[model samples]
Target: MSTESVQGGGNDPAIEVTPEAAEEALSLLEGEELDTDEAGLRLFVQQGGCAGLSYGMRFDTEPEPDDLVVEHHGLRVFVDPASRNYIGGSKLDYESGLQAAGFHVENPNVVSECGCGESFRT
Candidate 1:
């Protein structure tokens, strides 16, 4: 696992997750009965989507050498080095509503977001 600090004035360039987010994810895992013993989450950015960049998340048990690992509330979250620039200072949260529910990323680097909220331009 690797970690680096984003450089800027008056900005903390680190990914953060709220307690609600952690609990929500945990609840989802429990509902799915997914094996979380060695399971972890991975977040990355990919090209495509209306805004040129899209977010990706997955569950993993291993991390690559260049992955940036973040831990919160006993949960391990991994991010690829290349995607770090786009997700700097972002927050991960879980949301549930009558219409939709899932993990959401609040990114400071996002300049614009698509109507579907599946992608962003920065």
Candidate 2:
């Protein structure tokens, strides 16, 4: 998508996507035959976890009008304003190990998390 199409909260975006994640996301988009320029991964925070916050993501055909858009390694990430408050300064990474292999969020804003590691609080 064009830079003008992105409603970035500021020139400096707090979210970062690692190269491995970008590559995996790009591959997924291509495999789905989605338009890379418009379709992207949408990251957000939900309030159902044991610690009150949880990370969520999905492939979106396009970003919402007010979503913050950040691109890295040719991968576009869309974040909603509300979620921004909970997930700022977070890193999106892809792990290909046999166990727990999937997208993981390394959030620096987290203050604590459940012992099971499925939820977090800030």
Candidate 3:
């Protein structure tokens, strides 16, 4: 229900962070005693999944020089150039339910995902 648009560092891909995700990420960052102004969630794609690519997320003290920086709802997200190719136009959301509760990336670039729903192929 919360709509928050991201401002990208360049004309590259843009990611939308839902209000829920922003709140949760900011809370986590604060819990870790990180600098909210500089620290951010690093989203990246790595090889190895059955579908050929898997998404990864972690907290970084700061973004790399070439990383794509985006800010939304007081939360900062950093994406490397290589990972941007697979996650552009994506929506980062947080889902809380009895079955699963976590940050999920609804990626538009995915053509198919593995049965487990952990990996995807473009």
Candidate 4:
């Protein structure tokens, strides 16, 4: 990741991917047989988790015309316009350890998170 701190700019991309996350995502893409020129990582926010909102990620072959697209560490990231406000300036990370291992979001916009850590409120 860059040394520069992330900030929310009106015209900036909604989210940023750390180098670690991008590399891990790329590896997963290949492992899952989803690696392709048109495939990209798609991140979005949805309602109905323990804290009322949750994050979703997947490999998408097509992106909406109005989505916020960002390219970092050789990975293409897509964020739906509706999710921009919720995840703007957030950092995507991957962690592998004895206790837990998966993709996690470090979101500055979250005001609170559920105890289980599966959801958050903004």
Best by TM-score: 3
Estimate, for each residue in 3-115, the C-alpha lDDT of model 2 and write its tens digit.
22335777544678888988899999999999998899999988877788888899999989888888878888999989988887788999998676789999888899998
- Per-residue accuracy of model 4 over 1-122 as CA lDDT, tens digit each: 44332222358545778888888988877787875455678889999788999999999985677777776776777788789989988989888899988999999999999999999999
Q: Candidate 3's residue-wise lDDT over 1-122, tens digit each?
A: 44344444477778889899999999999999999998999999999689999999999999898888888888889999899889988999999999989999999999999999999999
What TM-score does prediction 1 earn? 0.79
Backbone clash total for model 1 is 0
Give candidate 3 regions above 4 Å deviation. Answer: 1-9
- For model 1 the local lDDT of residue 74 reads 55
Candidate lDDT values, in order? 0.75, 0.85, 0.89, 0.80
Q: Give the 10-residue window scoring lowest on summed lDDT in candidate 3.
A: 1-10
Candidate 2 regions with alpha-carbon error over 4 angstroms: 1-7, 11-13
lDDT of 1 by residue, 4-120 (tens): 332221242667877777777666656767665555678789999987999998777656766776667756667777788899789998888999888899998898999988999
Report the lDDT of model 1 for residue 77. Answer: 68
Candidate 1 collision pairs: none
Clashes of each: 0, 0, 0, 0
lDDT over C-alpha atoms for residue 28 of model 4: 78
